[model samples]
Target: MINQDFLSRIRRKNNWTQEDMAKIIGVSRPTFIALEKGIGSPTLDQIKKLADKLGCESQDILSEDIVDEEKYREVLLETIRYGAATDGKITKTKLAKLIYLNDFAWYYQHLESMTGAKYRRLKLGPVPNIYFSKVEELINEGVLNLEIKKDGSQMISLSRAGQMLKPNLLKTEEKKLIKNISQKWQGKRTEEIVKFTHEQLPYKICRDGEVIPYELITQQDPEYVY
Candidate 1:
């Protein structure tokens, strides 16, 4: 079940029109429109072609219709922790890349749109506002720190509270979700899985190698307990 809304959301967040995306995927505009509308299903070959053009995993596109939000949030938090723990400080680009791998495009777009006053990109690039909002909220809650540099680059790292909260946040339910995701996608490339999942977790790698993030809409459903 390909999600029409998810497809539209991804297209809009990137500021890409249907026609623009169609051109990129080497498909006729009508064909692309059909895909988005869920009137037709793309073959595996078409999925691969689209993934290559989008620089994302096949799972991202495939899973759009059946995303489980609670599972997604746990994955996201874990990814953040992993990124933060890697070098004791999470750079915005690294966090962004991780988020991209998780296929949170709307959130990524929000980060791009809202990171205006707090941070700037090293290059002329879109900042992800949703990421910033989460970061900002976490910062206000004493879960993270936002370090702005004179050179316009930003550094984000977990706070003491964030560090403490990380392990506790991973309950048995989350662990199962993580295990399932890992088992399903193990040995597969992130981009490939992301594209295949395609519900809310679709991802696109920016030109600078940063993974553009998006929102996990399924997370918003209250019944979606991990």
Candidate 2:
């Protein structure tokens, strides 16, 4: 069920009238009223817009009862799966860079991260330690397999025993950006991708193991900015 009271409270707290909120969310005033009156459900995009307007996380705007850990896990696994599907195989470095790009791309456009993972400076680029841990957990549970090649290259492959991703887990915009990121970087050599990242403003400014803030995306050099 939708938390109409919470939505109404947040809207009111922002000092926005029904019309103002509706316009910001790109919905008709009557439709916004219907949503706040519990007569209609809000789609993921609407919820995201509301959260942005209200200056809160989408999960916070929707309901405080539901945690986002599972959502994060799903996104992490799906990103790897999508990267593998993009190239028939994906190296660990490439997969990490793809996820990094997706997050930055989404942030640049939406002013909010699609997956709120903290990225840190690494040899390749801004890599998320949380993603590494989550991947390890999935591997331990037989959801994915990691292979080490003779040349010391590592790759990730999906295991057949794992549950398939739910079709509606990601919003259309999110999926589109992920696919675009994968396709853009799929065939590039690991070193080339790393060089690209190194030239980007975020990776250049951050020290090793430091958290790379989303704000840094704005400092991108025009020559190679995303």
Candidate 3:
């Protein structure tokens, strides 16, 4: 059975009218309305097309409901562990940019986000707001050990305190994408990564505190032409 509420949310989130969504998904307006109203069902092929057009996973479209919080926490922790393994530790800012790159770059290449974490345009660039709470949860759970020290500035380092996260949690493509992103940013200073992210179209166009839309990744930027 098709998930009408999820479909409706996806369409509205993209700012598409019912007729517009119907046309894009190759359905008549009435058919689309029926689906949205839970009076009709979407065939498997239509579900595939909807996922493709919406830039989401098929399960995301077909699943009975959205439980984003738990999934978000798992992805964020796994990604942090992956990044922390590369270097002794990853700075908070660099980790934030890495997360942003993984999401936006995946969107640029596949029109989908690996974790689908919401990001806000901040002075440091795009920052995933949920990471702070996730980190706290991990610390409480003893999955990570945090070290705070002062040099010229405050410094924080995260080290694994438990066994490595199981590999099965993320899809193969998602694991590969996160690893690729971590390797790409490895050895780069936090400032350099921040500068690079500041150049991305999403970060450039969104005002401070504004939510960066995944759709913005499809836009052509003069600085970084696709």
Candidate 4:
């Protein structure tokens, strides 16, 4: 239970299935599945072995504060709310870039990312692997609607603008940063924002499918940061 989110996230990151994790952790498949679902947990020895195989400390796997899922969910919805076009929809590609900009830009200033999500460089730009699953989860929960346009671009929008919730995990400073970045790109074409992100130092230097390190963003000029 302590690292339920971590177990889920790390397993996904490695492209491992429950059976694979079960074997890696020396547990039965059903037990690992229960651990993933937060129904139970692995023994300390199992956790230690799994941590060793993953080449990380037990604390790294057990630490709940490493990433904030609540903050991530709130940020995703808030980014959708702020960056959507006047028609109240944002192209999925552009939405992802905007969120990446917000995260890295915040890290540039505070030396810590807003949500602590790991972002990798992809064809669209820099984005977290979790972004896609989180958006899909939201859509499944009826909080978001995904529409495919005639051009084949996926558009994301809130089920209702009035459904916005107060963010307990996000700060005023964080909200302001999201708003400012969203404002800068709101009227621009998705191509423009995608190009801007692609041109950023973080994106330019990182190889395809590689995680863009936050430290690299610190080396960028202030003008190109966003």
Candidate 5:
């Protein structure tokens, strides 16, 4: 079941009013209130939409289950491997970009549900500074590394310590996560496979049974889970 308290916390973190969120998600103010208050459970479709809008995975909202420190380290190692495989090194900026981009795709899909309004068109923009702050925290903890150049663009990469831990990150866990996502979005305009790259995570939008990767599917507000 979805955690209403978790939803409330995320809402407050974003400084969004219930009405504001209701408008974005295409729900009535009263319905949104009911949802936040734990008076009802949202439909599967509604949950899917909500997951996207909040820039979080469904697992993040589903229960109080928390990933322990061991699991956290494992996932971070996998992320480093995936990121570095595309390039020799994983930078902080790259990590931030990947996390934010994925979140944006999730949120954009659920925008109408969150705001309770007609889904407006979204423009891909630069990542916000708050994301950088989160990235910095990770860097300070030795999870990632930042190489700043004179040109002002920093090459953010994962640390060597992070790289060594990748194999311990269970592939079975990742496969299950992707499988759940696929089932949740079955037969929708959304694609079955979401590929994350060094540059962007492609959100393939289907048109007439044909998959087309749209640039509009870029990430917006980014948060690092670990």
Candidate 6:
């Protein structure tokens, strides 16, 4: 059930009325009431918007599992390190799918995502909404670089390999999974991985642009995963 009290408290704390809450959530007043009364469940997108407005992680409103952003950044760096080509660059789209596979496949096994970040279905595949902005942030920090190719694809690479944090934030298990995913997808064409993720149950059942529920992966067959 959605935490009705949290919504009410946050709304009140901000001196906002029910109408204001509805506006922020992009829903009508009655629908907002239904959500508040536990008669309806909030969509992941709505939860994400509310969390953004309040300057908090989406899990803060939905669950106790907070998103570990630093660890997520580390995972991205490690994915690039393990999965990049000999020149140490990975296509932006491919990198997104690789991280999605790592996170969702881990969730399939452990009942939790590696980053606790929410992913939304997009034309290419399931990707966290923040993936682009986060990549941009890394580029700004001189931790990663981006190049636009003649084919219109964006390629990313580490600006300085040594700039990656020491005593990595990723746990052993997490790093292992990323390495395994990297090896398996190595040399695979971008089209092949795109087809693979597009066929997964979580992506298949969701509408275009919908947030994919992590629970759906539980129903996916083992071999079909990642």
Q: What is the lDDT of residue 19 in candidate 3?
A: 89
Model 5, 18-117: lDDT tens digits are 9877776678989988887878866766656767886787665563222222433343344444544234454443444343333334335432111111
* Candidate 3 global TM-score: 0.64
- Residue-level lDDT of model 3, residues 88-143, one tens digit each, is 67677777777777767776777656555678889988877677777677778877
Worst 10 residues of 3 by lDDT: 151-160
* Local distance difference test values of all predictions, in order: 0.49, 0.71, 0.68, 0.83, 0.45, 0.81
The candidate with the higher TM-score, 4 or 5, is: 4
Look at candidate 3 and tell me the lDDT of residue 20. Answer: 87
lDDT (Cα, tens digit) per residue for candidate 2, span 74-175: 665666666674435668787777777877877777666666666888877888766777778978999878899999998887777654645355688888
4 versus 6: better TM-score goes to: 4
**TM-score of every candidate:** 0.36, 0.65, 0.64, 0.73, 0.36, 0.72
RMSD of candidate 6 to the true fold? 9.1
Residues 96-175, candidate 6: write the lDDT tens digits. 99999998989898876777668989999999866887799989888898999999989999887424555366788989
Q: Which runs in model 1 stand beyond 4 Å of their true positions?
A: 1-76, 85-87, 104-129, 167-226
Q: Could you tell me which residue pairs clash in candidate 4? A: none
lDDT of 2: 0.71
Q: Which ranking of candidates, highest lDDT first?
A: 4, 6, 2, 3, 1, 5
Candidate 6: worst-modelled 10 consecutive residues by lDDT: 1-10
| Candidate achieving higher lDDT, 1 or 4 | 4
Q: Which has the greatest lDDT?
A: 4
lDDT of 3: 0.68
